[model samples]
Target: MADNNNYRDTTHQSDLSISITPAKAGVGLLFAGGALTMHRILCLSALLMGLFSAVGVYAADAQQSEPVDPGIEGSAIDKSAKEKSDSGGSSFAVWESKYFASSPDNTGPAVEQPIEFPHFRHAGDHDKGGMEINCMYCHTYARRSLVAGIPPVQKCVGCHQSIESVRDKPRIKKLFEYWDAKKAIPWKKVHDLPDFVRFSHERHIQRFIFQLNRPVQEVCGYCHGDVKTMTVARRQKLLSMGFCVTCHEVKHPVTAEGGTPIGDQAYWYSMRKPIIDASGIIKAQGPNDCSVCHK
Candidate 1:
């Protein structure tokens, strides 16, 4: 009887140990799951806080007024508005000039370039510090290509290397740095047109500069503004459909002063063919048809 009782006691002790072991494992699992849940909640809270902070910062920035940089000129809207008001033009005139004139926003935002090339120093009038370099000398492709190609770095260094006077200048130093590194000066395009718009710099250059014999500066100015006076080039003209259409609608003289008829020297798209009016003067209009430009 004593042996049997001892055997029963050992079995009961073993069973109790097994039951307690399972309870402890269940408690541990519960604690681990709770901890995981708490961690996820904390992470979600942090993400929300970050998102809210970003939104608040954006709102604050949106409300704040942008400070004008002295180096950059004011937008065309501001200049035209003031000019119209000064001239005693009506509000409608001011509105029209601001939106529909040569450019809606002349002199666009100043694009920060690798080197701040001083257009005034290079292209400005001889009375000023400008070298009076011809536009064609650097932009050689304007008359020959669809796009006015950016000049290679070698072209700039070729001339700059000989000019020892301004070699030490900061801008020139930067130019040399790029040359030494064998990198192209990444010029930012200020007059960026939309991808869909088709513009042929060659056609315009051939017609105005070669055939019409218009001043290079004046012809370029019709779209680029007075870049000769600019430090860094900016979009001085609007280049909008309205600006283009306005010029196209007008009937311009087909011949230059010497009566050199604007024959099919260059393929120019026009709504109507060159016509001889009652005054015996040949006149041609620019492309007014959608297909001529849209394609």
Candidate 2:
């Protein structure tokens, strides 16, 4: 009996030490499973990151070493011109605001010319630190060509050769440098039109200005603003088709007594569309012909 009781006690102690409660066993199993799952997820994430990094490095290296396609480089200007010519000229000549120029180039709205050519000083009052120079004298081609050509350095040196007062001035000194080198001043072109649009200075000069015998300022002010005041030139006109069309549609009244003026250029633009003879009868007239502008 003693031996049996001792055996029972030993068995009971072993059970107490080895056997776990149901809640504790379940918690242990859950912790172990969670640990295994987290380990798998972390290993997978590391592998994916390595693959992505290698791909990114390879892509960067390929991009830096590769040459761009050759055909894309030279086709831009040609394509642009072809489109414009095909369209038979768009009325919106200077569409982009940043592209517009009056007197061109520089960081801001005002461009510092190679020589700081002061329009205000040259164009303003003679008594007020001004020479009051005539614009046509400098822009000789304004009366003749589509381009109002920049005056040659020789033209500038002509008068400047005798003027002793401002010879050492920095702007004047720079002028002398170009003159000495016999190089063009590389004057920036202010007014630039697109490839398709064709504007004739001769036609406008002959038709509206010379025919009407108007003031030079009023005549040029149709496109160029009152440049007499501005030190640096700026584009004032919109130069759009609508603005031009409005000008064409408006008439200049006859200034003399007992006189009737012709009603704008649009009236006479047609080819016998509204035919009228000198004897008392008036016919239809208007100037909305596309061919007149777009050729």
Candidate 3:
């Protein structure tokens, strides 16, 4: 009886110990799970903060890079006054007259020797040769770079290597010598805009040719004139500030309805186009303040 009682006591103690062990393990597992969950929360919060900071930095950078718009009110008035001043009594003939002579002394019977480059003989449909090459072929850097670079003599000799049998072509032969010596030809600039104006061939070509779906030749013809027909180039137009402003005005004309001039309306309509409000109502923006261009 004593042995049986001892065995029963021992079995009861083992069962009690097993139940307590499970409870303790459950508590420990719950604590570990809570800690893991807290860590995940902290990591997620840090990730969100990092993303927010990055976005704020990008927004600030974008704002700094963007170009400031000068107001339209003063710009419109200035442009209007300029037009009136230019056209009030100034004759076109007077404007066309040369201000400076070729020589400083103004002597030698005014050697106004026109370079009569036979475009017909060089490029036109003649039996000898009529190479229908692109204008950018000669002015190679027109598309890719800021300045339209004039081709050196090496570019000419690439084709003239076989045509050495031509008669009395001293200029062509000189080009060969320059090519052999690897020297650049000194070509005079024909179309010279003021240094202040930031005119870029690349930007114009990218906009008109690539974006606006215009032909390259037609776009280039605006500034270069008919390059295909010209062997010796000349400035075809007087590219003045007024000229640019006039074109801008035409494209975005002022449309006033009341006694007060809708200067802001005209400005926005001209500056921002297809991206404007569908209702065609011009949103007021900064005026053509002096700092816009002068700066």
Candidate 4:
């Protein structure tokens, strides 16, 4: 009987030990799992740090690259002229190159338009069988508005309907189809800037055209290349920050000594107010403030 009682006591103790074993094992497993998770997190952080360091080095190399000059890259102006002519336009006209930078490398991809408007026929030199129409005649808003808005269909129809010359032309026929459909032609934007950038065509037009009394073509050529020679308008200038900054750094006479009045003082204010000199001349460069272009 004592032997049987001792056997029962041993069985009970064994059951109790078996029940407690899982709880101790669970605590140990939880600690081990946490250590493994921490190790994985540290490895991930090191990988991310390595990736960021590589990006920093690449950005540094890009920053050290040579700067682009506003002027065309050539030993002589004649060579530069030949380069421009070979790209798409005629021989280098000083009017086209005067205020803007032009290079074959800077030309943008040719964009396909809904109706291939013949700019060369309309705005090119009169000697080349062109009408020699002023740019402002079609793009009327450049002087007053922020954007040089596209002309309405009616504007084109007004002249085209009256003139029978080239009415049967394929491009003109496509234009007429849009007019008959009573739908606006979805002309693709050729020169597009980032959403963050704010450019005022009105401000530039006013300064270069009205205030400076520069030829409209020369002034417009500062951003857009010689459009007169192109069949369809294409981006010919770089239109980058470097291009703009290069032009802005060069000092321009604010008022050309009774040539054109600056008009309202408030209208001419850009990043900073212009300073008048002892010779009664207002000479200043373009707005260089970050807030001016970054808006």
Candidate 5:
């Protein structure tokens, strides 16, 4: 006997469907008495043919109605939504800009920091008459630790002491007070993630910039926005689990539709390696398990 699992039923979304059963058709035909005219048999045959044709067409339409792609749709990124923003404008970029547009963290005009540290002054450019300081200089522990350690008051003092460029500024006055007090500067957290998720700056930085040797902007731009423009730091992306998952998949993407990484000459991706602390016993492999993040 044929397996029931192999049988295809085409009864979806139809009020009156054509179900063909060999035994029933045979029995119904057999019951036709000898009094039945030849025209009646021909008419019945035509009706059956039409029903079969309808079933075939219905099946075809069902398949085309929905598409399944193991490589594209299965990823954390939404393929259908992505297609909508493919034209010159980036869908992810568009979403990132407005993700926290109206939140408390985002002040419509500007972010009010304890000290009005201008990112544009430090990370901007020589053309803008800005110092264009390297981010790592202030965020020293970025590549080596989970939390990108904030620059201490002394870091600011060390420069302002001699530079005296903006020495008399009120914010600079606040900096000197903290230095004199011998206390940690109370900088507010900007990119605060949920307590459940464990993010590693070491792993990401090592992979993208160290291993791949990609540019700093591309590496930093992955999560932090274009800080060169903003005077105060603010979040650019949603920073949700889905956002992290989508980026991770895209970075080392092997199953993308084009069989290539989702990057272009205009903006390329950073490639980083996983560090395994095996107590000098074995190399550590980056985790892909639920407990790794949740715990």
Candidate 6:
């Protein structure tokens, strides 16, 4: 009986040891699973933070790279408005000359014969042979002086002196006669600004030529229009006082149509209106202060 009881006690002890081993194994597995899940959560949080930081940096760089658009804020509105008021009447009339009479005496010889000079015809290109010279070669002072000078009889004679038998045209013959008589040719002024206004060829040329680095041909066209195509030069631009003021106020270096640079040509830099037509003739009103212009 003692032997059988000892055997039963040993068997019970073995069974208890087996059960404890399985419980220990399950607890170890649960702890490992919790640790792995925590590590994965931390890795995911770090990745999300890195992505957010990258996006923020990209946004800042984009803003800095953008270009600034200059608004039309610095304009002289008052001067412009006044110009519009003055030019409101007789928008089409050229210079208001005192000598101009509406009607001439019918009995008298036709005093002013219209010079039927076709600007387009002479400027056109022909298939057989034709060469066009720029207007500035003859009207050299247009870009450098306030008034574009008409070619003197001497200048015409420089070329005409050599050419013979081409005196059929009255204007050409008249030019030669003026040269022979040592008299100045009386060419009608086609475009004249008002007396009170001040305009500068030097300023425009300097800004466009020296500062902006524009070619002469392109710069001259701003006022003269395409002289290459015109036979008889007419007033191409309205050249109104308001037109001058508008250009001053907007402060664009070049007209928007041409991608020309206005650069330092902006009026504010000069501290005075550079161009004015105040005298009612193409009157330009520079800055209002006396010191602005006189000083």
TM-scores of the candidates are 0.56, 0.50, 0.46, 0.56, 0.57, 0.44
Between which residue pairs do clashes occur in model 4? none
Whole-model Cα lDDT per candidate? Answer: 0.60, 0.52, 0.47, 0.61, 0.55, 0.46
The residue ranges of model 3 lying beyond 4 angstroms of the native Cα positions read 1-129, 164-168, 252-295
What is candidate 5's lDDT per residue for 142-222, written digit by digit as tens?
899988889988888888899776778887888888888898777877788889888888888897778877666557767
lDDT of 6 by residue, 110-151 (tens): 223234444444344454233445556677786778666777
RMSD each, Å: 29.4, 32.5, 32.3, 27.2, 18.7, 35.2
Lowest-sum lDDT 10-residue window in model 3: 1-10
Candidate 1, superposed: residue stretches over 4 Å from native: 1-107, 252-285
Q: Write out the backbone clash pairs for model 3.
A: 70-287, 71-286, 71-287, 71-288, 72-287, 72-288
Model 6: how far is 44 from its true place, Å? Answer: 66
The 10-residue segment with the lowest total lDDT in model 2 = 1-10
TM-score of 4: 0.56
Choose 1 or 5, whichever is better by TM-score.
5
TM-score of model number 3? 0.46
State the lDDT of candidate 4 residue by residue for 146-166, as single tens digits: 788899999999999987988
lDDT of 3: 0.47
lDDT digits (tens) for residues 55-82 of candidate 1: 5544433433233222222232234334
Could you tally the backbone clashes for each prediction?
A: 1, 2, 6, 0, 6, 20
lDDT of 3 by residue, 128-154 (tens): 465656557777788777788867667
Location of the lowest summed lDDT over 10 successive residues in candidate 1: 1-10
